[model samples]
Target: MLSRKASCDSHGQDSSYFLGWQEYEKNPYHTVHNPTGIIQMGLAENQLSFDLIESWLRRNPDIVGLKRDGESAFRELALFQDYHGLPVFKNELVDFMAKIRGNRIIFASNKLVLTAGATPANETLMFCLAEPGEAFLLPTPYYPGFDRDLKWRTGVEIVPIHCSSSNGFRITSSALERAYQQAQKLNLNVKGVLVTNPSNPLGITMNRAELNHLIDFAIDKNIHIVSDEIYSGTVFDSPKFVSIMELAMERELYNADIWNRIHIVYSLSKDLGVPGFRVGMIYSNNETVVDTATKMSSFGLVSSQTQFLLASILSDKKFTEKYMKETQRRLKKRREMLVSGLRNAGIQCLISNAGLFCWVDMRHLLTSDTFEAEKELWKRIVCEVGLNISAGSSCHCSEPGWFRICFANMSQETLQVAMQRMKAFTDSSNSAVSQQQFVNNTRARSLTKWVFQLSSYESEPHR
Candidate 1:
């Protein structure tokens, strides 16, 4: 026997979103080997600007050698394993974050707590802010991994604010009120609200009205606001990504008590296409949280080797500037290609402007307007259409027919093959739906006649 935590299925990895990944791995589509096999569009990874990163890495040979200024810094870094992290790395990291936000928000290296990645960064924040069983309110159709990262080991609960597609799933005052009340009914102390600006599933940035409303609600409720901005730099189109700290200053809330309660989780996983490095940060004005999270970083600290490599790369302003611009240009083009391809298949997205994926409406493709139908449609898409995608239900979306289809993980030619497959499937589905409607109508008429005959027989059966 093992500990309950080890044995239990609380990690939430069995969700369909992840299962789709399994499906992709089983029969992956390759342009050369398996052109007709399933093409993976379920992962939110950025492979667009790796060339730039690689070019820089090639030039900076000393980074891997652990040498600075033609000398060795290996021994010092090798022996160093403090939770405080390398100051050079932190300084450069925070400065890089500022560059992503248009040099608008200046992040302090002192207030930043480094973790292995965004996953642990979020879990660490939950540990700092809430006791076990306290809750965080997340909007509907959120990043499904939150189920595990925020709750699995921490024992925190996630209450859905249940934003609707009516207003493009924008967080609303009414939805917030409803969610908070629901949490109250469950007798859970709402510790905070977590949001992903340049939202993971939606690929849409939160407008200022929504941002102000969220901050005000958090202030009124006296709850922490954890803004997960991992995809901050991936924002390729307008309106640009808005850091909560930036907005707080604009509204003069930076000087208020609310600023202390506002925490941001940032990572190079999405922005820098370096998930393997596992570099994540937590920035907060709350000194206690920063210190507590720093202590917690011992469990998932970024390795010194990774810190050095990143420091070298991020310190090169010329490379970072060119990288960001070229990255945006490529992402915008890739996004356009996916959008245009989906349009040819009669599938329209949620008018998203950022992120590596599109939250497109596939409700018309569903057999019925229900989550069950969403699952069925998803199964068909994955199995029959040979495309791996995430259904809205996996994201806790209340509505059906929406899916997150990623575009940045594969080549343009591979994407074209996927689009061709999607177009064929949709065309067939439209015909099948029409034929099924006729079949249903005929079955209804036959059932009515059978009922009349059965009633007449019953009336004479007394003999």
Candidate 2:
């Protein structure tokens, strides 16, 4: 009835990640109205720092009004803008990026390409980097959204570089070799490797050794390394973030072939708690790539007014610095609360230092050590326990029984309610049933009656 990608489930929004979101939306939990309904823990959104943004906007009404010192500039902001983006915003954007990375390296504004958001930025990169049927490797337990962002429209393929839980799901040289070999076996052309630093599902940053290994792999394979560093600013704890560029500089890969091959996908969505702004960027050493991306960016330009407002916000060094510290402080507090809540429920999560979510281990809760059992447990948690979380399987995790539970998007009271629900579910599931009995019991429920589907939010892959 339409294009093959459109006609198929390849877009990947129909799976556990999104289905849970559907269930949550249908009967969302509210303290006053629907306390028994599902608490949405599936989305990886940052809402903790909106107050700072509001405060800043309130103080700068002229910026908010697209005016300079009370003089209206609405006509200029409302008119068409170049795909190259506002020079002021791009300049400040890089400065913000540099400040986030502890100012280890400075980014060239001309080398940056602007897009509507990280999703489109990634897609645009895939369009420039690889052809249909070409593949890029990804680490397991990745953000579920990459399936749509990197592959859906581009016809690019994702070959998972499986990381083991034994090493905290850290990337290893052996995994890269295995993944590349696997791609070769499938007769696929390898384009590059895509990674999320302060990773999405795992919420941990890649160390220096791993970054060096990635550079080695890129050089050896003659491929690129697309580091999705949208969560760079979300790193709240120590052993602080080490950007791939920082390492590249230390190793002096600048202006080299390896340098040009490294591209970064960054966004204001997670860092600013403003997904509505739709401002994302790609910073590469390859000028041709930046130019090509800029041309392609016309298809998804950042609105000029949004750029004007952000330019005003970011240029205030004091405000941005304070905002950064405050954001980290709140994120750390929320992270501790979620972890504490889980611990109270007799659950443990991967020790994470960044991002809006926790990679929770409910492996002990499953009746069997298989993905089917994982899905079974996931369904029960989402449908019965009244919480929606992304299953590890959707993140292409090698093992079962892990889930991403987001804490930044909800209120403290709601989070407490979710903690209580999780505790109740954990307590009830203590007297575990055999796999057969578990399957039979789940079969007895009216699945369709409760999980009526209506869906988006680019759901976490399968969100």
Write one digit per residue (lDDT tens) for candidate 1, span 1-463. 8999998888898999989989989999988898778999998999998888988878888887889899998887888689999999999999999999888988899999999999999999999999999999999989999999999989999999999889999999999999999999999999999999989899999999999889999999999999999988988889988988899978887678898999999999998999999999999999999999999999988999899889988899998899988988899999999999999999999988889999999998887889899999999999999999999999999998999999999999989999999999999988888899899999999999999999989889575
Question: Model 1 off-target regions past 4 Å?
Answer: 437-463
TM-score of 1: 0.94
Which runs in model 2 stand beyond 4 Å of their true positions? 431-463
Number of the top candidate by TM-score?
1
With a 3 Å backbone cut-off (N, CA, C), the pairs that clash in candidate 2 are 15-462, 17-463, 18-463, 116-278, 459-463, 460-463
TM-score against truth, every candidate: 0.94, 0.92
- Residue-level error in angstroms, candidate 2, position 350: 0.7
- In model 2, what is the error at residue 314, expressed in angstroms? 0.5
Candidate 2, residue 42: lDDT: 93
